[model samples]
Each structure stands twice: as C-alpha cells, then as structure tokens.
Target chain A: MSKRKLTIAVTGLNNTDNPGPGIPVIRGLRDSEEFEVRIIGLAYENLEPGIYMHDIVDKTYQIPYPSAGTEVLLARLEYINSIEKIDVLIPNFDAELNTFMRSADKLKKMGIRTFLPTLEQYEERHKSVLPEYGEKYDVRVPKSKAIFNASDIYSLNDDFTYPVMVKGKFYDAFIAYNTEQVKMHFNKISSKWGLPVIIQEFVKGVEVNVVALGDGKGNVVGAVPMRKQFITDKGKAWAGITLKDDKMLEQTQKIFSATKWRGGMELELIKTNDGKYYLIEINPRLPAWVYLAVGAGQNLPEALVKLALGEDVKPYENYQVGKLFIRYSYDLICDIAEFEQLSTFGEL
Target chain B: MNINRNIAISDTGFVFDPSSGDSYSLNPVGTEIIQLLKKQKTIEEIQVEIVSKYEVDDVQLEKDIIDFILTLEQYNLIENNE
Candidate 1:
C-alpha cells in the first residue's frame, strides 16, 4: 500500500559527538510506515553533517540563525516553503525553538504546520523557572536558583550547600564545589548562554530519561522511558535501553495532562536509591535518543507530525521494555563540491 | 524464592536482566549462588553445598549467603516473594 508523502523541514542537523536531534528525528520520520517523507534539511551552518547525508536528507537549505529574530527567520522560511512546499517544520534546537514557537502562527498562515509548545508553556519550563513549574504541577524538582551576577553566587552559600550544579540558560552544566568555582562557572555560562545562570542542587542518582508526545488536549500520545547504558563525556547518551518503568510513565502522563503540552518533550530525571524520581530538566522537544522510542514501538515523531496536521492519534499503550539503541559514529565521504555548493549558494 | 525468570547468567559471571535491561558482573562465588538459585535451590541447600566445597564454615557461610541474597534482592535480581 502506498503511504502518504510529507515534506518535513527540520533544523539542528549537526550530527557531531555532541549531537542534535535533527538526524534522529529525520530517521524517525523516514521509518514511518504511514508516511513517506521528503526530508528538507534546514541547517544554519554550511558544515552541518546532515546536509551531506544524501540518503537521509533529500535536500538542504540554509536558514538564518534564531538570533536574527523571528521576522528574519520567517522570511527565510517563506523562501524555502515557496520552493519545497514543506508540510511540516520541526525546529530541534533549544535556542531556535522560541523563534519557531513565536512564528508558529505566521508559518501556519504560510501553510507550514508546526507542532510546538506555546511560548507560555516554553517559558514556564525554562531552567530558571523549573522550581515554580514543579511546584505548580506537583512534580519533585531539585532546589535551584537563577542568579544574574557574581555577588549572587556568594549569597548562594546561604541557600545551597557545596557541589551545586551551575548551568547556563540554554546549555553547559558544571558541578561547582565552592563559591570560587560557582563564580567561575557563572562567568563561563553567562559568557556563552547569556545572563541569569541557574544553580541547582546536585541530586545524587542514576540519570534516566523519557521521550513523550502530548496532543495539546491533556492526552499522552506516547511515552517511552529509558535508562542510559553508556554515556559520553559531554553527557549525551551513546547507548540506551527502553525501561518498563511505570512510575516514570505515570509522571510523564501527569505532566502532559497538567500542562496540556503540545508536541514532543524529553524529561531528564534522576532516580534516587530510595526509588524517588526527581525532575532534573525538561527539553521542550524530542531528545537525541528519540529513535530508541521508535525502536521500542512508539513512533513519537510520526505521532507529532500527525498531531501537527490536526489528526486524531490513538495513544500508545506500551513499548518493548528492553529495546536497546547504540549510536555509533560513521565517517561519510562527500566531495568538496557539495560543501562549496551549500557554502556559496546556501542550498544543496 | 522467586528469581527473575528473565535473568541470564553467563559463565564469566556477567548477569543480564531482560526485564529491566540491567547487567551486573558477579564474582565466582556470586556466580555460583546465582546459578544455584536459577535451579530453585533453597538458601539452606545453597549454604550446605558451598560449605562442603569451600573452606568456609556452615554458620559463617550461611550469614554470608543471606547477606549476598539481600544484595541480590536490592538489585532486583530476585523477586520479593517474602
């Protein structure tokens, strides 16, 4: 039987050691039995590996960075959509999601559907405001504070003990053992991801994760909990296994029901020795290891696209408990002309 | 005692739990106990077998076996049928 064809424009194509979710998301879409996808690789840089992955990405286009603002991004998308006639656009970067979320309506008017969290939903789950989100939603979150300056770092001692996690607004996290280390991390993080660095209490436990999708109607489309079997130094999962964790699944359903979250979300959680789960961070999109969920029986990206198209999707009841996904690096040999094409023409 | 039926013990003492996808490496004695448990050997039977083969006394070995069983239970290698 012939499947429905979808042209999905996806960003975050840099499939490096510190990988992005684009390649994985694309992989999930390609694996869709229901939809035959013509993947439009939306890249910010010329050298994003997914652009060169010919078998994966049908075509690649350069888009303006999110820092260029929503108008500029929408204009670039307008041009891309004119040619490709993209059905759905999935922005996979945390930094770029705000721009996409803001322009979601404009893109819809331009006939580009996107399933993304609302701006309010996005801001409420930000690292700085996680404590409040946890409190409002009845989730167990680590004690944390958002500090703007170095003076605030000194005062953190009054509220927090040593060995707190100093984190950037968007990325980069370090364990600071002293006030001096906190100040150093504060400067480092602020310099990179801007001000209002977050300092969270260090929760000692094994890191587990869940990739889930919500239909924007307080319904869980799918949820797959996983435990990392191997981790990279950059803290990305090299290999992970799907778990039969009912508690984690219940927590994910609770959060989705509470927030009525739209699109995909990854819950970073810490499972303590006493079996209590602590919500560490919530990535407002599907994670790099999302393909594991696909392997486990829940095709979240497929469900997300269905939701974006306003289709009623049945919630997945179960996934293969012990399905494992091990990611490996492959060296793709591409000619320099392909690089020159993307660099000079901004499309390939 | 109900050991997880999905647990697979390799000769090299590597234990893999299919249910949880958790793996553990056991020492020789630990491997022996797991192998014995897989056969539905009771704790007293395991204690008697280990005491006869090894130099350790029955009383001390019994205590050690119980401690090891507790650790196995903690790791979810065995079901809490108690």
Candidate 2:
C-alpha cells in the first residue's frame, strides 16, 4: 500500500532581499518522509523568484492581490482548485491570512483545508493589542498605543518616552527619537500600510523568537526558540541559533494554552538586561526563519499538514540546541521568456 | 541622460548593478523603456514607440516616462553626464 500524495498550495513565495516563508515551508513539506507532496506555488506577482524555482514548486499561479477583496481571491482559488484539486493551502503572508481565514469555510466546502488561527486569536495578537493581550495572558509586554492621527504623537508623552518604537499596522517599524520622527513615521507608515500606527515603549534588550505550533486544544505540538545572531539593516535575522531555554518554551506553551491557538505562530520577545522577556509581537503565521526549526529537529510544517488532515500528532519533546542557520542569497538564473509567459497567462 | 553601463537590464524587468550589488524589478513597460534607453534612444523616440504600442496618450506616457526615469535615477541606475 502506498501513501496518498497530497497537493499543497502555498503562498508568500517572494524570495528576495526580504524573503517570505513559502520556500522554506515547501522545503519542509518536501523533506517529509511520512507523505508525498506536490507543491503549487500561489504568488501575487509574476516575478516572485519562487515561481521560477521549478525544482521546488510544481506549478505557479499568480493570484490577485489581497486588496482585490475576498470575492476576487475566492474566484481565483476556485478556478485554480478546479484544475489542481489542492488538498491543503498554507498561506504564509500576514496580509493574505485574513482573506483566507474569512474564506476558510468556503474553501473547506471545496475540499481545501487550511490550519490557521481563529479570527479572534488573530485579532488579539496584533501589535496594537499587545498590551491588552499581555495583561490577559499574564505576559510582560511593552506599553503600546495605536494612534490614528500624526497629531497624536504630541500626546504620547503621557504613556511613552523618547526613542520609542513606531510600527505600522501590517509592516515596517522605526525607532522615533522625537515627536517629529514619530509624526514622520506615522505619516509614512500609515500612508503605505494604512492608519492606526502603533507606538510602543522601546525595550532595551536582545531579541529572541520562538516558532511554535498549537493544536487548538491547548496542546503545543512543537516549539523552537532561536536567538538572532546577526540582524540585517532591515531588522531581519541574517543568522540565528536555536537555544535550550525552558523559559521561552514555557512562554510559548502559555500563549498556546491561553489562546488555544491553531496553526503556526512566531512569538517575538525582547529579553531585557534585567533577564525578563517582554513580548514584542506575535506573527500569526510561521516566520521566514521557520527552516531553522525544521533543521533543529522538528518538522513543523509537516506536523501542521498532518494536523490539518485530522491526524493525531504527539507533541515534540526536544530539539537539537545550538543549531545555527545562516541565511544566504542565491541568484537563480532564469530566462525572460518564462517571466513573460507567467505575466501574460497568469500561470506557469 | 544615460543609464549606468554596468547595470544589467533583462527582458524580464530584472535589474542588477554590478557596482552596488543591488538588484531591482520593474514592470514590463519599465523594462521596455530601459532596453530602449540602453540603445541610446532619445526620450522622444522612446515615448513615440511606447505611445504607439501601449493604449496610452502622449501626455500620460510622457508623465509616466518622466516619473519612471526619476525612479531609475533615484535607484542610481541612471547617470546624467550633462
């Protein structure tokens, strides 16, 4: 008897200077020995390098951007599903997750499965709500406020001080040393990513991240903590090493149990010089550095697929500590004709 | 106005500058304009070619070309020797 081959569609395939988690997630899926997989790359733009990585992605389809609304996205997915019969979809982008989560029921009706956090779980973990989330979860989070207007920067003195962090709702963050910088970043980020720019107290510490998976039943299936060894100018981890930290592991479990979170999550925490971990952000999806967890010993993407398939998976007890992941860039040689084909046909 | 000779502009709109090790992506129209620029085509000639092929007017095309050129210059892909 042979195992059934699963066709898994994945998004966020933009592997560039700022990479996405799709390629690494696909790598994890392909590395799974328990099941075979056929990968369908769901991309937003025709030029996303992962679309050209034929060795990893079986087929690539350019879907409409999330700004096109869920109906457009669902229509595109329906057409794609009619051809590929995608059994599971792993959406890795923060912006696209909302559309997918909202359409999860409809997608499930079409026989496509996705393991993701509930809308409530997703909303409560947003950067602007981190303070309340920390209070509710008994976690230590830096004081933060969401400001809709740049004028609100003048009033931040009530709760915030100089050199605070100004963050966009969806992306981008800057350390604002004064009210002018705060107003500048607020306008810049809000114009690009929309209103409700977040202002947070700057925690002076080293940043550590934990990638964990929960079963939606208070059980953390897998967790891996890593300290960023080298950070890029864009604040991305250029190199990271897995750590043997019980405190971080406990924090991950606490969040999972409290939220009964489903699917993959990356908890960004700042460890203060006083040896206390302050929660920074909770990315509702897997981090770009997820391959580090797969390398360290836990194949989380594979486990997530199994969980999505309704299989009972046991919790992973341990991972190899001190495992290092050094990120590198490779220029894939591809012809112009391929890009032209995808650009014209919207599929490759 | 000139494009940096070291800048490689592929048909796919992928741009790479060897000196800076910076890579960029462009839309199809942007790629076509860069290719024309590489051939030393004047802005007027490029505009005429684009307006003929694209469903755009001269005024809009001229405005877009200027904006695109400004973007290219911002990325250090263009050099103004004059």
Candidate 3:
C-alpha cells in the first residue's frame, strides 16, 4: 500500500533548554504510517537547532519574526510555499500563533493548510482572560486578576494572600511572597512580554497536564494526561509518565465541547490534596512533551494533520496508560559550513 | 487487609502499582507485611508473624501494624479496608 505523500511545514524549531513543540511535532509526523512526510522547518532565527537536523527536517527556511507583522510573514510563506507546495502548516509557538492564525486564509489560498484555533478562541484563553474562560466553560480555575500597573500590586493583598503567582501574558511566571516581589516580577515580565501581567493565587498541589486535539465541531480526536516525574528549574517537565486519569480527559473534553475549540491544546492543571482539579492555563498549541501522547498511542499531531486536510477522523478511544517519556539533551556536531549556508542564503 | 492484585512487589522491597504506575520502596518490615498481605494472610496472622520474628511487645506491634496499613492505604496500594 502506498502512503500519501505530504509536504508539512512546521515553526518553533528552537529545541533548546526551553524547548518548542516543533521537533516533537515533526517526530510525530515522521512516525505516521499513513503519510510519507517531507518536513520543511520554518525557523525565525539562524540558530534554531531544527534547521541543523538534516535527517528530520528535509529543508529549513528562515522566516521573518512575528514582530515584523502578518503581511511580512504571509509574503515569506508565499515565497516558501511556491517552492515546497506545503500541504499542511503547524505553528508551534504561543508568540507567533497570532500571525499564522490571522494569515490562515491567505495561506489556504496559497495552497498551505493550517489547523488552528479561531481568533476568539485564541484571545479568550489568554492568561489575562482565563478567569472568565473558566467561568464561561464551567471549569474550576484559581483566583486571578490581570493588572496593568505596578501600583495595582500594593492593593493585591486585599484580594489575595502572599505567595501569589506573578505571570506574563505570553510566558514567564514567578511566585511572589510580597508586594515588592510582585512589583519586581511585574517590571521584568512587562518589559519582556508586555503589559497586563496576571496575578494568580498560588494553589499548592501536584501539577498534571493534558494534551488534547479538538476537531472544530466539538469532537475531541485524542487526549492524553501526564504527570511530571522530574522538573527543570524553568518549570518544564524533564521526565513524565502518562497517567490513568479519566478526570483530566473528561475536563479536556468538556472544554472542547463548551468552546467548540479547533486544533491542538494543552491544559495546565493543578490537582489539590482533596482531589479537585484547577485549570491553571491553556496553551493554544501542542506542548514540547506532545510526543509522549504519540508514545502513549494517541498520535495527536498526525491526527491534527489529517484533520487539516478535511479527512474524517475517528476519535481515539483509549491510549496506553503508564507510558513514560524522559527528555534528554544531546549535542549535534556539524561543520560551520552548514551554519554559514543557513545564515547567508536563508534556506538550507 | 487486601493489597491491589495488580501490584508487583519484589523480595527486595520494591513495590510497583501497575494501575497507577507508581513505584515505592519499602523497609524490611513493610516488605514482609506487604508480602503477607499479598498472600491473603489475615491481620491476626500478620501480627503473630511479626511478634514471633521481632522482639516487640504485642500492644506496640498492633499499633505499629495499624499505622503501616494506613500508610499503604494512603498510597492507594491497598484495595479495600473491608
């Protein structure tokens, strides 16, 4: 039987200490039995490691940053698509999702398909608006408020106790024990990720996560829950195990049903001592540990590509429980010629 | 009085619960108690075995055994208290 050949372009290829989902997403696609894939890595920087991984990424093209705006990004994609004829595009970064989503139709016209959340679905689930999202979706969430100014930190004690969480809009979070610490975190987060930093009441518990895919019409294609066995100082899961957690799966389904969410999502949840789950945040894309879902039998990234191509996908009923995924770092030795090629010519 | 049937306990005191994928290490006493429980030994039989092997008083051994059982229960290694 001949497998369908696909040209899939993926972004967020910075597989560093703070890894991106691109490499893992590419791994899932490469593992697909139904598809023979030609992976085109869309990288924003010359140093993205995925560009150097020749065996994994057939070709790598340096694209403009999201800071350059959607027009510049769409123009770049048009140029890349003219050559590769990309069948499906997967954007794996939180910071760049907006640009790709905004240009989804333009990419479609250019013959590139993308499976992504709608702008409304994207905005409401932002960390700043998560409180209302939890309420609207009927999910339990920690008490939180988005504050725009440093003075707001002084009055936070009236609503929240000390040892609260100070979070940025896009990334970065710090546990602040006092007003001074909150102000410091606020300045640091604001300078990097911009304003409306969120202050959340810290919930003490074990952190468990669910990676799930939703087919725009409220059907969940796959879901896998995992608990971190080891954590890095950056709070990324170093090692994790797939869990037999029905509640987490149910919550993920409920969120999909309520929102009619499209594309891939990761739910960051806290399970308390009393066994209640709190929805901490919703990442609008596949996580770096998403390959664990593939190892556990869901193959969400493959399902996502199939869904993008308008294929009828049967919802995955079950995944292998107790599957473990441990992440490791390895250095890839390459000559400076490869680096020079990517830097000078933009495509390698 | 019952350990989860799916649990794999080693002679060297390593306990692996297949259902939850949680692994635990046990001391010699915990290992002995868990092994006896896996064999469907009654609480009274376990108490007798511990008292005969260790130089501990009956009342103290009973208290210690109950505490040990509760700890196992907390870890969800035990099936049902009944």
Clashes of each: 0, 0, 0
DockQ scores of the candidates: 0.48, 0.01, 0.45
Estimate, for each residue in B30-50, the C-alpha lDDT of model 2 and write its tens digit. Answer: 899999988888889999999
Docking class for model 2 is incorrect
Q: Please, what are the lDDT tens digits per residue for candidate 3 over residues A91-177?
A: 999999998898999889998999999999999999999889988889999999999989898999899998999999988989999
Per-residue CA lDDT of model 2 for A209-289, tens digit only, reads 999999999999999998888888778888887876778999999889999999999999998766699999999998889
Model 1 TM-score is: 0.92
Query: Which candidate leads in DockQ?
Result: 1
Instruction: Give the range of the ten consecutive residues with the poorest summed lDDT in model 2 chain A.
Output: A238-247
Task: Specify the highest-lDDT model's number.
Answer: 3
Pairs of residues clashing in candidate 2: none
Distance from true location, Cα of A101 in model 3, Å: 1.1
TM-score of chain B of each: 0.90, 0.92, 0.91
TM-scores for every candidate against the unseen true structure: 0.92, 0.80, 0.94
Question: How many Å off is the CA of A315 in candidate 2?
Answer: 1.0
Whole-model lDDT per candidate: 0.91, 0.90, 0.91
The residue ranges of model 3 lying beyond 4 angstroms of the native Cα positions read B1-13, B17-21, B27-29, B38-41, B48-64, B79-82
Those runs of model 1 whose alpha carbons end farther than 4 Å from true positions after fitting are B1-14, B17-21, B25-32, B35-41, B47-64, B79-82
